[model samples]
Each structure stands twice: as structure tokens, then as C-alpha cells.
Target: MRENKSAVLNRFFSRNTFRDIIDSTDDEIYKSVILRYVKNPENKKNVELISEIYTELKKNYRNEYYYKNTLLNKLLLGVHSINTTVALTEIPISKSKADFVLINGKAIAYEIKTELDNLDRLENQINDYYKAFDHVSVITCKENLALLENKLEIINKPIGIYVLQNNGSLSIIQKPLKYSDSLDKNIIFKILRKSEYESIIMQVYGELPQVTQFKYYSECLNLFLKVDLDKVYELFIAQLKKRTKVEKELYQNVPYELKFLTYFMDLKEADYSRLNSFLYNQFGGM
Candidate 1:
């Protein structure tokens, strides 16, 4: 127990230790962990049957990545697959942002709160999401489930709640109810880049304002404000669908541990390939 694989894993991933590994100019701990994993991946991950070991280390930072990887795994296994384009991550709404916002026919925002995260800003985050999306879910670990439930009751928002199970899957505690908000068209338009707005306007109205860069924003805003809210929403969803058709091949070669980071977080192809090679190299015999 003193120097076993799990003990090393727990310590290596602890908040302070991880910080030291990151902050150090040249930390041997980082190299040793990676080398050990490359040589024998299974030994470090003994928590599958050792529930208490996992429970004690649940609050670690790396587990934040692990939890999301689990959630992505859950999404892949369930009705949601890699087929539909996951439009955005860290989607800015009112003030805060959604962790993952999947858009195809419908927009569903997922807000992740790892065990290490505080719920202090959750209310405000939920409120911001409501302004843009109809369906919003707060994904947290089992430890925070009750606190989220109580907070949900007080806020009275039809936000969904999901708990990360010990088996590395998500379970819905409260199903989210979608409520259509009379969203400001200006706000909706703000979500789009200048060229996206321009493209939509050209397609819909067959015209773009003949103005200088300085005057272009005001002109675009005027034009967007005149467009009906429903039309704007429809066009937004369509643009999202068109813009976000992900290359399935990239995900085809993705590592299970980095699934969320690769797909959901939009890791650069080069970086993903590097990570995939580093991790999967061992799988095939490094």
C-alpha cells in the first residue's frame, strides 16, 4: 500500500503534486508516470474494482478530464453518437458559458461540474444558458447530487441533473424540460461570427450592406434586428449543422481516455494525433 500502483496514481494526480509536476522546470515524476503507463497501463488503473480507492481520489484534477471522458463515453453508447455535429464547447451566453453545446435538430447544453468544482457560479451559469438554449443539464459527480437537487428546487428552473456513476457513466437524476424563451434576436445574432451572419443574410435576404468596416456592425445589427426571431433561430441551427460536420475519422482513432478532449473540446488534429499515438502506442506494444 505504501508504494503500490494505486497509491502512486493517487499521489501523482493530487492537486498539489500535479501542480508541482506542471510547475517544475523538469519533473522526473511526469516522465516516470508516462513511462510506467506506457510499459503497463493496467496496473495504474486498479480503481475499477477498488471502489474506495477511487472514491478517495475522486476530487483530483485529472479526474475532471476522466469524468468528461466518461460522459463522452456515455454519450457515445447512448442515443447520442458521433454522427450529429457537436457545435460548440464553452459556448458563451449571457455572461458565463456552457461546457458542451450539441446542436443538430435541437440544441442541448451540458454544463460540467467536476467534484473539484464549486457550485457558487452554477445558478448564474444556468441563467445564462437559459437565455440561449432550451435544454440545459448540469453534470456533476454523485457527491454533489443532493446539493444540486436542493439548489434546483430553490431556483425552480427546469434544468436537468446528471450524476457521474462509479462505473464511469452518467445517470439522469432530473430530466431537463425545454422551455422556449423569447430570446432577443440581437443576442442570437451575437453568437455568430461576422462572416456567418453575413452568409446567413446573403442566403436569406439576397443582400449585404454596402458599408465600410467601421459602419458594418451597426448595419448588420440593424439588419439582424429586423429579422424574425424564429427565422434567426432556424438559420442559426442550420449554420451550426453545416459548420460543424466533424471528421468521423479523427474520432475513429481517438483514445478512450482523451475522447472528450479530442472531440468535445476540439483538440487540434496534430495534438490529438500526438496524444493518440503516445497512448495507443502502448496498446499495440510500445
Candidate 2:
């Protein structure tokens, strides 16, 4: 006879830390579960059965997970302080529900996959997301990292990659890659408007041409708007050599539109407000 899998899940969820595991310390519980299951493979069939039941629960509770992850990613990316509007569970171009959409004047779609599912669907979902959104990301646990690396070779599109453990800790496994010829104007504009253009310049140049400009722009705009300009400048210049080398070897002959970006980094303190105003006008400002 089939065991009452619900009973097993109920028992698991009833633990005082289950909610904490799901809410705050997911990676710890995830590692614990894997370790416990590995140590006690005698109960392998039971574990698989329980996992199946949890899959059903996850499907039913996907919305809850989606919202939770949005909140989680927001905190992880420090989105709240960036003045960007964030939305959750947006629809993909496929009209299937995307797990999260972060719009801080730029559209970023996030799809969350748990341990129960293969990442094949995620690859397809991210592809669809890119068609409808400006950026695409997948949030999964470390157990799925191998799968993402394998898929990355086949899907050449630039997509943000993040690991969201059972403990709710998020680590950027793969920063967003750029697949388009067009510069992400919104991100570019934000970086130009920032007081820390010098720092933004250094970090942005550190990445490969396809990724460096967009990622650096987004990161600088997202983080430096409130920090002291001097610190930002120091940090930016400190990494300049590394960025310069990366640009020469990996992103030679960078597009003219993006090259204009380098100019913002060299501006005088008195010139920042005017340069920002110029950039805002050029990009039609967010």
C-alpha cells in the first residue's frame, strides 16, 4: 500500500524550524536534508516518495514561493534602496507565470526552480522571459548549479544566475550576461546619473564587453546612489587596471555608444550634475 505522504510532509513541516528553514535559513536545512538522506539511504524510497508529495505542494504553493523569492531577491540585491519598482509573479512571453519581475526602470524576469524539478524547463522559460523582458534570471539552490552550467553552454543568451538556498540566502552564481547588440539604456543612464561615475567606470570595465557594461552599470546605479562619492571613486579607480586588461583582451573596440560611457567616469565634481542631466536627456531618463 502507498504510504500517506502527506503525513510525512506534515511531520516535516511541523518542526519548529521548518518555517525558519524555508523563510530564513533555507541553505542549512537544504544541506541538512541532503546529508541526512545520504547518510540514511536505507530510507531512499521513502525520501523520494516524500519529495513527490512536496512537489505537489510546491505546485499548489508556487505563488507563495514566488512572492517570497521576490522579497528575498529584493533584499539580496538591495532593490528597495535603489528606487526601483519591483513586481512579483509576472507573466512570461509564453504567458506562463514567471516567478518574479524586478522593474527598477528595467525589466528583469526571475524563474525559481526547486529541488524537485529538472532545469530543462527553466532554460526554456528563461529564453521566453528574455523576449518579453530586458533581463532574465533563474534562482535555484546549489544542488542545481551543475545543471545550470551544463545548460549555459547551449543557451548562449545572457541571463542572470543566482543560487537561493533553503535558508533564503542568495548568492550570485552567474552574473547576468549580455546577448543583445543594444545597450541597456536604462541601466546606462542610471550609472551616468550617479555621483560615483569613476568607480562605476572601473567596475563596468572589469567585465567582458558583453557583460561588463550592463552589469557594472546596473550594480553601480543600484549601490552607489547613496554612498559617499570619494569612497566610490577610490573603489572604482582601485580596480581600474584589472578592468582595463579585461576590456583590452575581451572587449576590444567597444561600441561607440558605450565608449561615450567612459567619459562620465572622468567628470569633475562640478560637472556631475550637468553630465547627469545630459545623460538623462539622452536616454529619455527613466
Candidate 3:
């Protein structure tokens, strides 16, 4: 397939594609990818075909989504309990968007450099992430491991490194140590939404900013800057954990391949039911 065609196939792991599937809405990209990838679509259910396609992608593509899904499966679900952890994606920090963020007791930022990705912006991206997150790590493929290790070592930062092994396991190359030297209150404030920051202010000071709507943001930011940075981080994690809470029982039923998408989809109970049905249905049956 051409690059353009492969681009269409990549949508299989996207949230919009799963949303369409759950809603039973016909998606051109889904149909096209399925038809092209599945050898005999007559007997295979949607879920089976998706798993097969994902397996192939892991071997060849190894795109950002593949890294994220593997992390969510192995680290989030396998290593930590979903009930105790919260995973966020594409979180903007300073000038870069963090690929994956896991908030357990403390937050860790993961910057994924897939085999297809270049190291051009990695240093700056890691710097930006440290403004808000204390622990930072780089997750890459085996090919990029040594280069990343050497680069990070030269920088002499406490950043950790992990390689997504071909056998589908995360190998810890270096464990990240907590480095709070770079934590900036202003940058942390920038990551929060108005409501989240407002909640933080209320919890800490027992009231919102005492200013007009025009000055509300500035007043809140000024107050946030005055609060202890460590307290702010604790509040930050508490606030973010509340952002995406799913029913544990229902989420446990979500397939491993779709865990990343499902976590960020904000799917309701009805949507899960529809998705469950769609996953088990054959192309003809659907």
C-alpha cells in the first residue's frame, strides 16, 4: 500500500474510528482498512480483525498509538491498577504535547520517539515536560535506544528510558529519578483549565479569586504562584485524576487493543454496550 493508503489504515487505532464503530455509523476509513487488511472478512468478527491488524502494525508500523496502547496495557493495567491510576494523552506542556502521562501517586511524562520519529525536537520536548512533571522518561524502539541513552547521558539528566521490545514487553533501560528542580509554578498553572485551577484555589484558600471576571485569570494565576509548589503538584494530580474516571467493571471488559482509545473516549455505558456488540459482529452480520 502507498503511504496515503497506510495513513487511512492508521485511523483504525483512532478514537473517532472507535466512536463510529460504537455508534454503528458507517466509516469509510474503517471499511477501507478492513477490506484491505483482513484476508477473509467473511468469518472474522470486527474485534478479531482489529486484533490481527493491530498485531501487524506492532511488527511493522510501530506508530505512536502502538507505543501508547502497549504502555497502557503493560504498565497501566499490567503493573498498576486502573482504579489507582489515571492515564492522559496529548497533554500540552509549554510548547510540546506529551505523548502519554500516567498519574499514580505522582505523575510521570512519557515522550515517545517511535522508529518513524526523529530526535529533532526531543530535547526541547523533554525540557517543556519537566516544567510541569517531575519524572520524565523516553520510550523508544530498540533501534533508537542507544542513541537516546547516549544523548541523555551526555545531558546528565535523571531521565529514564524504556524500549518497546519486539516481543511486546517494555524493557526499562533506565529508571527515571524525581527531579523537581525544573518544576515551575507558572508553567504548572498554564497546564490547568480554568475550572481546575479554580477548584485548587478553593481548596487551598477557601474561595475563588477576589476580582472581576476580567482579572479572574490573572488573580488566580498570581495566587497559584504564591502557593507552595509541592502542594500545587499534589492538587494538580488530584484534579487531573478526576478528569477521566470510568467504571472499573465496565472498563475491565474493554479489549487490550482498544484500551488507550477507550480510556480517552469518555464512553458512556450505552456506548460500551454498542461497542461490545460491534466488536463481536461479523462484517456480513453488521
Candidate 4:
């Protein structure tokens, strides 16, 4: 398969595709990609087809999904336990969207630059993440490693780097050190939801801001700015850690290829049962 066909693989691995399977909804993407890519898919279970396609994507394409799923599998699940760690995807921070974020004791933003991706906005993306996070890293394939390293040299902060080798292993090219000089309180405040910052205000100030509904937000911001930035960073990490929690047993039984999707799907027990049934069933026709 050519690299330009990544969109087809992207659709095949998307949340919408798996949502169709769990909800028993029909989508043409499933049948089209399966028939086009997998041989004798009719006889194989959905899980097997998924594994085969994932392997192909890893080997040939190495698109953004492959990088994220691999990180979640290798770093989040492989190195860190789900019970203690939280992984967030596609989080908007300042001018850029953070590709993947891992929050254990400290939060680090991972910006993925696959071979298919360009570095036109990498500097801006890295700068945006530092406002809300202390540690930041860029994960890219071996082809882009030298360019990324050269790019980082002129950038003032200590940003770490990792290479996703062709063999599907994450290698730490440069370890990131904690840098807090760029932490902006207002940017950090904006990253939090109303309830999150409110909780922080109550904890630190012991009272919610008392103002009109229109002014309440600004007043809360003013109050938040008064708190120490380091303290604010700690509270921010604590709040984000509560956002996404997964069902341990259900997540464990899910195929490795689908772990990233399953983690973000916010699956209920009934949904898990439905997905399990779908995975075990042969394609038959769809």
C-alpha cells in the first residue's frame, strides 16, 4: 500500500469505526478497508483483522494513530500502570492541540511528528505546551530525528526527544529536564474547566469568588493568578488526572491494537460486553 492511503487506515482505526462495531451500526469504511487490505478477512475474527491491519500500518505507514496507540501501549500500559497513570489525547493548549499527554506524578506533553507530518508548526506547538506543562517531548520516526535534534538546539528550553524506530520500539534520544520558566498562570488557568479552577480556588482560598455570573469567571481568574504558580501547577495536574478513568478488566481484555480507542471511548460495562461479542464474531459479510 502507498503512504498516501493513510486516510483509509486512519478511518479504519478511528473511534467512529469501532463505535459502529460496538453499537452494531454499519459503516462502509469497515467493509471497504477489510476487503481491500486483508486477505480472507471473511474467515477471520474482527480482532485478528485488526491485528493484521495494525501490523501493516506500523510497518508501512506509521501514521499518527500508530504512534499514539504505540505510546499508550508501550509507555502508558507497558511502563506505567493505568491505576496510577492517566493518558489524555488531543488536548487543546494555547495555539496548538497536544497530541498525547501522560500524567503520573508530573505531566509531559508529547507532540508526534510522523514521517508523513511536516515540521512547519513544531516550534509553535512546543512553545504552546510549555505554558501549561513542565516537561515536553517530541516523538518522531528515525527519518526526522536529526532534523528535530537540530531544531531543538536553537530553542532555549530543555525539550526531550524520542524516536519511534522502524522495529516499533520507543527510544529516548534525549531525556527532558523539568523547566518551569515558561509556565504561564493564565494559560494554565485556561486549560482547566470552570469546575476544575473553582475547586482549586476553594482549596487555596477556601471560598468561591462572589460576583455576578458575568464577572465570576474574571474574578476567579484574578484569584487564581494570586496563587503561587508552582502550587497552581500541582493543582492542575491533580484535576486533569480525574478526567478519564477506565475499566481495568475491560481494558485489559481489549486487543492491543484497540487499546488507545478503548481508553478514550469511555466504555461502560454493557458497551464492553457488546464490543467483546463483536470482536469474537467472524466478519461473515460485514
> What are the models' TM-scores?
0.74, 0.40, 0.96, 0.97
User: In model 3, where do residues sit more than 4 Å from their true spots?
Assistant: none
Candidate 3 yields a Cα-based lDDT of: 0.87
- Ranked by TM-score, top first: 4, 3, 1, 2
State how far residue 32 of model 3 sits from its true place (Å): 0.4
Please identify which of the two predictions, 1 or 3, would achieve the higher lDDT against the true structure: 3
Q: How good is model 1 by TM-score?
A: 0.74
lDDT by residue (tens digit), candidate 3, 139-174 = 999998888887787767799899999988999988
TM accuracy, model 3? 0.96
**lDDT tens string, model 4, 1-286?**
4644877888989999888878884567888888888888989998888888888888778889999999999999999999999999998899899999999988999999999998889899999999889999999988898888888887878998999989999999888889998899999898899999999999999999778999999999999999988899999999999999798987899998999989999999999999898888887554
Ranking by lDDT: 4, 3, 1, 2
Q: Model 1: per-residue lDDT, tens digit, 97-216?
A: 777776756887888887667889888888777777778888888888888888878878788888887656678888888765836676677788878899888977799989998999
Better of 2 and 3 by lDDT: 3
Best model number under lDDT:
4
Q: Please report, as a residue range, the 10-residue window in candidate 2 with the lowest summed lDDT.
A: 243-252
User: lDDT of all the models against the reference?
Assistant: 0.64, 0.45, 0.87, 0.90
Candidate 4 stretches greater than 4 Å from native: 1-4
At residue 35, candidate 1 shows an lDDT of: 53
Clashes of each: 0, 6, 0, 0
TM-score between model 2 and native? 0.40
TM-score-wise, the better of 1 and 2 is 1
